[model samples]
Target chain A: MKAPRRGLAALAPFLWLGVFFAFPFLLVAKLSLSDTALAMPPYAPQIDWSKGLAGLAAFVRALDFETYARLVSDRLYISAYLSSLRFAAIGTGILLIVGYPIAYGMARCPPAARRALVMAVILPFWTSFLIRIYAWIAILKPEGLLNAALRALGLPALDILDTDVAVYVGLVYAYLPFMVLPLYAVLERQDHSLLEAAADLGCGPTEAFWRVTFPLSLPGVGAGALLCFIPMVGEFVIPDLLGGSKTLMLGKTIWTEFFANRDWPAASAVAIVLLATLVIPIVLYQRQQARILEAGR
Target chain B: MKRGPSFFNLASVVLGLAFLYLPIVLPVIYSFNASRLVTVWGGFSTRWYAALFQDEQMLDAVGVTLRVGFVSATLATLLGTFAAVALTRSGRFPGRTLFSGMIYAPLVMPEVILGLSLLLLFVAFGLPRGVWTVTVAHATMTLCYAAVVVQARLVGFDRTLEEAALDLGRTPLQAFLEVTLPNIAPAVAAAWMLAFTLSLDDLVIASFTSGPGSTTLPMRIYSQVRLGVSPEINAVSTLLIGLVATGVIAAYLVQQRRRATA
Candidate 1:
């Protein structure tokens, strides 16, 4: 195929992405600058495109930093942002704790059992995310299975259903597959000879893991952390369902502003800041990914 | 591939698998519980399953969800296959970096932002939010997922078969249709399933975009769940879990059979 013609074959998808993905980001940006109104379509200083440049200029002139000012002046949004980051970081940390062993174990399984082991890891991933989160609620509620089992074991029945613990459970459960898959991908491809060499040098198994395997797996850790943390920052359902009254995550904040408060401009402004907060880590992730790919080549 | 890490690996696998499957299996088991409360097991009965069938609203949501999943998955697969082919074939083009970033960005972007932003876009265009809007939104999100999976397959594809087909006097389209398509069909099918699952599983995105008459199964479940966890939801969740588990196992069996034959 002719090069340009072949390139044009890509146009359809490019157009789809442009219209659907990039354009929405643009729309969000524009909406963030507008003011919230009590009217339908809900934002003020609506850009009337029919009036041409003058309309655009008028709209620009009408824009104010009032919504952003509200975001800063109110402690709620600020605390929400910080807490979202905290939740995401803690959730990611727990996922690493929970997922690394599983991935490492799967990676190290004997060749005969390896396929079934990996399949077991991935089976949960194919199930409905919402349903999975829902499944956890029944098990974590006040009179739930865990408490029942705890009582049976003659231990204090912990009440963690509406607490941060529950949210953490939800977040880790939801994002564990994301963490494990990347870790598994990296860990599976590792050279066994490196471990053998480390062992040959008189390092014990634990020492070998710490010195050789752990460092080699850092890329997977980073990738998995990035995968889990980025989405967890704006996670809605997990925190909403499991968190009950306690969790004030940024994603919940955005959802509340738009749906409950009917404050479009405020929601957009909050989203803009959340995006700004994420840009640094996201850029760093992209850079690291690129570097890793280059090194692999 | 393994030698002496026996005890450690075995313990980790058992604990991890238990953690992964317990919540899932419990929900399935409790779907048969005759108790009004979720935790207690009064007795085994299929009453919840019966209630699920009779619940008109839940049935409607199921219909809407399946329609959305089917339509969105098909569109996403079609668009995603083309995008994957282009990434593999067209080496580099203008805006290629931005193009790839867009493809990968959505894979990790928060569903909340993606949903809200797209809702705003729909409102800006004065489009009604309903079944089609939800479908479009879902397709947009899942297309990224589809592209990633299909791209991985295409990247490792052997090219000599297509070259041979071309050398045998087949035209480019003919070579692609006859050889390339067949080779990548498995990946494409896999992509479609992924897209379908993503669409079916979506709650945040669908909630933002769906209007009256377009309530999806997850949306219904979310609303019901917000009130309280009902036995009906457990039954529904069980069925969905069963569907997905069966699909995964069948795919594995197919792969294993292929490996054995080869």
Candidate 2:
């Protein structure tokens, strides 16, 4: 009775996941296999024995290294990929630089003020995301607040809109919270005695932080970097809003292919490649998490 | 321990907060600016807010977004709570690693990939793109967040109370209902609110799955901003900012009161 009841409970979540999550991916996999034109109503599941394999053959033909070759050869795709990497890397770096002090302060704050400090960090998130990005437009445009302020201060008005810099600023602004939260989570849980010990060993304040605090915060840093970097790589809204029409990112390319070109197969092909690229880091993170869990046990 | 106040730390914190707040504050301030151009403040007025109230498309989008958020948040919370309870209560199981991975996958998957894949899935399955599709996608993503928060609460939960209730002749269901439910109610409530906010703020998946009539508030805002940032968007954003602040403050106060009592 106990075993069956346990088994039933365990099976419930998997069933839910299989139906909702796994089924969608499987459908995508199937769609990627069959010819797009033939995938309509009265859907054919039959396969020719002479064709050797069903989905496999379809997948092989669709896998046409052509798309991959195109992605590599095209200057647009190559440049976009490189720019996306640069944006993600630069954004992550900026977030770490900006977030570290805030996280450190919050972690060290008095109990009464800690929650309030954290609240401030999370306060911007309350507004709709698109609205927040829109706010940047009000600030970053040529005639926007930023340039107006610069002109008022007797400085040359810097035209930031539609620039890579604007995209980076927006990406960092949006993702800073993700970086801070994880860093704060790890930092707040740290023992202060370790820092004190370092200080007592004749280490200066900065030295203490470098030697003791930074190493201990690596997990949070890694988690934060991963969180910010992963999504920022494929970020659509920021680049779309701030980068203007001329900027080409993989996300914009994918969107145009699906909505503009109506090339569903090619779009799926791009998506599959993007998905495969993301899966590598994710698998590594999962393995790391598993190892951590194992060590804890 | 005897170190003086660190002005460097203070300066950095101040700068970080300024960077985060300036854009948010500028829009709120400009919502009242009488000028058509966002760069200049001719005079302070509530005219844009008045205009926002009159926009039919904006109002319709808000209604659609609210409906989607409500249904998705409630359903996701329920499902997440069930999964959390099952995972926590059942000591060990086969494929546990796989189960955990499935739950976390949505949290990490890029919205672009998830959105495109779901779009393909909908097309393949012959499901019409609409509010229902958007809700399903939002719930799938937000459920993972709800699970993580509730699971955090469960990991620290004392299970002996449930065991005692069972020993006192309560059925397993009664024990769970009477004992476990009361204990974790706060986390469940928090999970629901978080899920709701997430569903409300979502744009990418909503953009992918929503049809003509199902455009959400964020989708509408994106469309408007894609053209140019209008004063009306500032007014709407100001109102949204107020709503979120009020909700967050209320949650904070309630949590504080509960902590005080405890």
Candidate 3:
């Protein structure tokens, strides 16, 4: 109950997060500027703490921007960034088309049915995310179930696996719940009387929806879009498992640089660039979320 | 509840539910197929399930996964609850914006960067990448999810109960433990489950942070699926589904019972 103790309690989380979360960014930022080397820890020049702060300053000054310059010169990184944005944008668009109706339908369900419906929606989402994505491989691969079904139906077999289409399918499938849940939360809180009021003012049903319901759900749309888009932009597993070498995703490129080429500094530079691209949407998302939280209270 | 055409809403809900469940159901059904090929259904058999149990690598991965989930989730919940409490109760402070930014950033941070950065940090600290390292990495990541869940619950909470406790001469920590905790227990429990599920399902971060003895179940599954699917994957997926279903139903029943009593 004491003021000093409360301050310390609040300080505890700040300290924990600062050390674990913010400190990593600092390390990555430093690593991003370092040169790749064939030494023990793989990237150089080390902090050289034994030489003290002056030595640290010298090492920091020695760090080059070549890795960053490589990202600009190499068309691969640019295409990868563009391709990631395209996939994520396409994924978000499809999610809106698919998720909007589902959330709206659930919102319109009878109260007794709505709870059960919400539970059902959450059930699959609660299950393993990777397993769900894995399930798609069986349905989309050449010798997979989709082909088998097509053969049963006397139709041509299609090979769409290891393509951007499969990656999009996987992205939309995996992230649909993320889109639906936020949309549902916002839609469920809408006041029905607003629509009735619109009708009373001589507005038609569809007209009333666009004028009132849709506007009211804008926050939900923003929230859902950001939730899906942000992760889709940096998605690694879907592109790796489902997309082709031609797909050109930043996430895959970064992963390959680190794991396959064993170039930590270059990967760090790419990651920082990715962070730069995402910074705007992230700030917007935070503001939108804060608005929603305020509205909730 | 209807605000529009009944047919449209009904069709949309049905289609969405079908799309969600069909993929899950196919895997479950194929998991029991006796045929070697996944597409064909020869007969019902437990052969794959038997094989899954017999596979030593899978067993080892399962052991590592369970340990990581238990340790990481528990730590994440404790720390996250502390964070949630601090965030919700504290009015505002000098560095609140920076603090909140750090808290929320990881929610949308890319897995690759997070993994790489954490790995670098571990390396910097001269820590070995094994079960303990995996535990620390997971706890740090999952704590954000737990904080978000608990924070949502705390937002709608009425502070009067805690105020009354304070008025009755209970210390802040004591009141928080006795009064606020019992009230927010549901959210806290949900946070724990979310944290555990995230840790269990993770592949990318664990791939970066794990060393010799810490190949998780998802990592094992990923490596296997690359080679190609066998009945073994279906069997494992089925087992995971069963586990999740049991937990969900149990939680649902408890919630319903609590609502009834309340």
Best DockQ goes to which candidate?
Answer: 1
TM-score of 1: 0.96
Q: On a 0 to 100 scale, what is the lDDT of residue B203 in model 1? A: 95
DockQ of each: 0.66, 0.54, 0.63
Model 3 residue A231 distance off true place after TM-score fit, in angstroms: 0.9
- Write the residue-wise lDDT of candidate 3 on A1-297 in tens digits: 555565445566677777777898888899899999999689999888888998889897989898999889999888999998999998999999999999999998888898898888888987788788888888998988889999999999999999889998888888888898889888998999998888889999899889998899988899999998998899999998888778888889888999899999999998898888899998888887666556655
Worst lDDT 10-window in candidate 2 chain B: B2-11
Evaluate residue A278 in candidate 2 and report its C-alpha lDDT on the 0 to 100 scale. Answer: 74
Evaluated at residue A221, the lDDT of candidate 3 is 93
Q: Residue-wise lDDT of candidate 1 within A12-91, one digit each (tens)? A: 88999999999899889888888878799988998888999999999999988888998999999989999999999988
Cα RMSD of all models vs. native, in order, equals 1.9, 3.2, 1.6
For A155-269, candidate 2 gives per-residue lDDT tens digits of 9989899988889889989998899998998898888888788878899988988888999999989889888887887888899888967776777777876777665655656
Interface RMSD of each: 2.1, 2.7, 2.0
- The true-versus-predicted C-alpha distance at residue B140 of model 2, in Å, is 0.7
The candidate, 1 or 2, that scores higher on DockQ is 1
Mark the regions of model 3 whose C-alpha exceeds 4 Å error after superposition: A1-3, B1-5
lDDT of each: 0.87, 0.79, 0.87
Backbone clash total, candidate 1: 0
Q: Give the TM-score comparing model 3 with the true structure, all chains together.
A: 0.97
lDDT of 2 by residue, B1-262 (tens): 9432266656766787788888788778889999989876689899999999999999999999999999999888888887777667765667777877877777777787778777767766668999999998888889878877787787678878988999999987799899998999999998998899999998888988888799999989888877766899989888888888888879889988989999
